[model samples]
Target: MPQGTLPTSLPADNTPKTYSGTKLVTYILAVGATGIVPPTTLTNVAAVAAAANTLTLRAAADTFIPSGSTLTFGTAQVITTADVTATAAGAAVAIQPAATPIAANATATYTNLLEVPVAEESNPTLTDQEETINVHGRITPIRVVNGKDMTATIRTLGGIDDPVVKRLITRGMSISPNNRERIIWLYPDGFALLATVNIGAPTRQAAAGNSQRVQVSANLSGGLFWANLNDPTPIWEAVNGN
Candidate 1:
């Protein structure tokens, strides 16, 4: 503890040969030490770990794929949710793809006909509403305007009345009160009925005031009267064996 002497634990050496060149010196011991701590802050957006390591898609079979779209990967690895469903339209069926599913009938659509191109159906098919059947007749007279046969006593002149003529007579197409015949102003383009007047569909004779004005006639329903045949507009063109 004194300034001039070393600690008592050290042994004293008096001889020059014992400690000739080297000297031992002692220094005071300190009680405390200091350290530095680093600063920590969540200041960067890139500090968080990535949400997903990889991007992936699921695959399946027997499913519909969008046109011109590719099924990215082939294996049915993650998912296989291929499904079949109906179309928005009536009675149509379809398959929908789940994820990246493959389709056996890829081009198939919901329809009456097969999706694949094939020959026309040979079996006795039901008659479609769009289908039409044709019948034949001869036009004896082109559309000609005849005067009102108000009291049609005309049929007795020739007992051999045409079938249409017979219907007119039975229907009281001419002489009856509401069904009384009038002069039809025929359309020049013979076959069409731009406007039809009495005998076909009866109209009351124009009132004296309305006489000058042209009148368009809607068809007359045969109430008690028989309906006359439609006027004979001469369709000169006739198909053989029609």
Candidate 2:
């Protein structure tokens, strides 16, 4: 090495030095290992209906993928809400033991042993006051719009009578919509929480072994990358197509 022999230039000091912005960039990390998005709700359904597929559901239902497992799928599409009754082997989901069955993805795997019913275009509709409990827990897709700790957008329209599964978005987690309901993951987050995080009223269930065993991560207002599920720091991911 020589002295001031003309340095090989330099990168911007203000810009992130990483190759991609979609990595582990977080607005805030959860404490003690759980990715918890403190309960927030979307009281304005009219505000959400502004989009074509306001509730975009992923092809598969997975919160996190265990290490050593594989995520597999066929094609790729922007998932909104998938047809549960039309998925691969997920069409037989039952709701007795609190089993949160998961749908397949481009490369995601199932650690929990619940039979996930294929999410179909037609979900069971219930009347108000009628209990909409999931006979079997499902790994459905929930979303964090504008960083509402309590409320998220699902691929399908959450029925007024159906109990939905709510959790923080897995940081850096993604789903590849191979087709209508078959999907998998590319990478997997090590640890996660599989509890029933209630946002609104319907009593969304995700008990220990019920039908739902899902994972959730947090993002600020809307970066879509790293989010603070339980952090009340007023973060906001940019709302596009609004």
Candidate 3:
């Protein structure tokens, strides 16, 4: 009776909206990398020096490897180098690899293939664990691949029959476990991440109280692939990452 109009609450610019004190998850399709398959391995004829990053082949490889192309040499040596020059067989040219060089024998090979980014989520846990030894109290050289998994809870205040909630309900029931899709987690602050995901069936629950409440839960897991040798960071701007 005292006020003629009510004040409207507006969210701050570049701020994320909170629901029930929890942030919502954003999911999307991931764009595929240009190369469908990994690059063919380039053969190495000689043993590369421990301090050297370049590779010497048995023949002129100027036509085989182009300039500004990213290639992987031996095992775990992914490098992006400048234009390669065609030189006499056994001539030493700069490899200019972006990452640490892997010690290679005569059988070492260089490849141009790359892994794709497979998944991203709102509350993601990425783990890259390594084994350590107690005898020397030192970290073991053995490494584990990075893995990610997260479960998201979705709630609807507009009753369980809400159109949007209904869509999710159908998706949870129909989506396949083998279907691999690209997912992107977007933030109001313009931060984003992209990854591949394998979705699981969703479960729904109902609460009994004065107000009608419904909740849906889903779990997903997958790995991420990277091709950028210059900067290998996963976090990126929303526009660029998307």
Candidate 4:
């Protein structure tokens, strides 16, 4: 919650918890029934099928939408629609708004959309290192692509035997080398990091009333350190059987 850099005080309990931020925003209306190609500047969305009534987004069911919710798109265009209920991934639903000719680069807004929260998170930090050299007794800066590292100590609030923690541990074991998820910091500007955890382990520590607590420190790496917090789209495309 510290703004404008320069660490005013120690990082307190204002940290985030473990969760997923995969959701859709708007998609490119392909040229099928409606021949409108949306602009590329849209966020949290992908190009849908040719059908204008149906919208397509990229995400898993539990990570994108765990419950039924309504989504609306665009104010005026070729096919202006409102309150379209999005229940399933890639499933089309009907809507009614106006038959005004939709144009290219048009976007829709969904106010009630929500992101899955991280169960328990703390000790969030962002570290960056720049490689510079001095030539002719003067500093000559050279740009390097070594991105920053984002790490944190995560704790499962449900104690040592939490189901979610066990599930995450199993998932980490299965997808160790190649897996990526977004870590979004819920700030006013919506900061985020696209990262993957190659190592995952849990430990039991003594707690109040002689109980045990489950926790682990996670190291997350990305192609780049920072990202648009609002968008949870994958940074790389995965090809099957390649």
Candidate 5:
């Protein structure tokens, strides 16, 4: 009937008794003390050493048992069967299930196009004119050939005052058009088109809320030719392959 001590009946003879079940031991500092130390459980208890007034209990591992403290021994209760089943079920539900990985396929797609900054609304149009030789005696034309009358119309965001637009306009208005080399229009797929173009005067249109737009018309002098943009050699000698 002391503070921090569990209520239990004492034996009539006041002699220590052996317990077969697991033993739980609690320690108290002194008599009538209020603080109750945590209990330690010992399984398969066996007396390793005994003497006239002393007995020692050994554990499987080294454990420090404090001295000068009152000890209380009690039987440790076993866990219920329902508790074990619930713990196993909860562990099984926590594990993630296996999944099948998806295989990827090869795709042919182009993400970028021209290097030059053009308006988003601009859609460049390329046109080709074919030349045919007329035979006076024959009803149908005898020889038909694709002529070098190719032209492209490109639209840009800014008007003639823009640097890029002004450069194109200057090149078109130059006195010596034949001295300039053909410019290359590059594509994302490593292919390029070469054309000695006569850049026409830029036409400008203004609106209230939108930026001024300029339309550039290019006339291919000798026609458009496909070449590799990464080729180190001359454009004429460069060989194109797959």
Candidate 6:
């Protein structure tokens, strides 16, 4: 028997017509019967124009936007060529998002207060008091320890005219205990130690043609506790869901 073959060409349609009403809906619904149709990315979009707070897109670019749909820029987006395609001659300038509010942490306000311009060194010392109890019949002695006393010495290039340095000098000159302020020692590993401190008089060393060196000392009043560098709220407060 001979093998059968299929036709290579088919008959052409002489009449063409557009589908409308229920036929158009039926065709669309049939195409999307399996699942929702996925959206496609629009390419070669022109820059957006803004006039009096109204944004307009060119006619060619309008193909990507639906007639009655609303467009929203998200928090992660910035209105600029770097973020979006708006680099045309009169394109809208970049508008950055609003700054986020700082966390209400214990040491938030004091974070930048002690930012010395040319700080050289910071030395912190913590000392504990010990009492020895000697029993007459015992060969060994028992030691009882008290709380720690914390102190710090900060060294920086002396600039008497600098506002921060001047403030430190003025605070050190006060003899009243009520002048104590909260001081935070932030570590590179995201840990911080916060303490109520009374600043002592600063000592200055001067030499010919050399910048003066200033050493400021601080005596921690209520001791210190370690916490997160940015948000140092106490563990108990966090546990209570504050």
The residue-by-residue lDDT of candidate 2 on 132-221, one tens digit each, is: 344459543344333222223222222222112211222213332111111111112421112222212222335464443232221122
Q: Considering TM-score, which of the candidate structures 4 and 5 is the better prediction for this target? A: 4
User: For residues 180-218, what per-residue lDDT tens digits would candidate 6 score against the true structure?
Assistant: 655555556655555667878888887788878777787
On lDDT, the stronger of 3 and 6 is 6
Sliding window of 10 residues with minimal summed lDDT for model 6: 23-32
Overlapping backbone residue pairs in candidate 3 total: 10
Instruction: For residues 1-242, write the lDDT of model 5, one tens digit per residue.
Output: 66787659854332322111111111102212222222333222222111112222323333233322222222211111111111111211111111211111111111111123444232223543444455776555333344334566655554453334555556556645632324445455566555556666667777788766666566666545565647776354331211
Error of 5 at 220 (Å): 1.1
Worst 10 residues of 2 by lDDT: 178-187
- Assess each prediction's global lDDT (C-alpha) against the native: 0.22, 0.23, 0.41, 0.38, 0.36, 0.43
Query: Which residue runs of candidate 4 sit more than 4 Å off their true CA positions?
Result: 1-121, 133-145, 160-162, 172-175, 178-182, 187-190, 224-242
Candidate 4 TM-score to native: 0.38
Q: Which ranges in model 6 have alpha carbons more than 4 Å from their true place?
A: 1-114, 133-146, 228-242
Task: Write the residue-wise lDDT of candidate 3 on 67-106 in tens digits.
Answer: 4344444333433354443344544445664254444333
Report lDDT (Cα) of residue 135, candidate 4: 92
TM-score each candidate.
0.14, 0.15, 0.34, 0.38, 0.37, 0.43
How many Å off is the CA of 14 in candidate 6? 79
Best by lDDT: 6
> Among all windows of ten consecutive residues in candidate 3, which has the lowest summed lDDT?
112-121
Superpose all Cα atoms of candidate 2 onto the true structure and report the RMSD in Å to 1 decimal: 23.9
Candidate 4 per-residue lDDT over residues 140-231, each given as its tens digit: 65764444556766554443233334544543455545323333333345554333444346565676787445566566643333445466
**What CA RMSD would you report for each candidate?**
48.3, 23.9, 22.3, 17.7, 37.8, 26.5
Residue 100 of model 5 has an lDDT of: 18
TM-score of 5: 0.37
**In model 3, which regions exceed 4 Å deviation?**
1-25, 28-122, 129-132, 135-141, 146-160, 175-182, 208-242
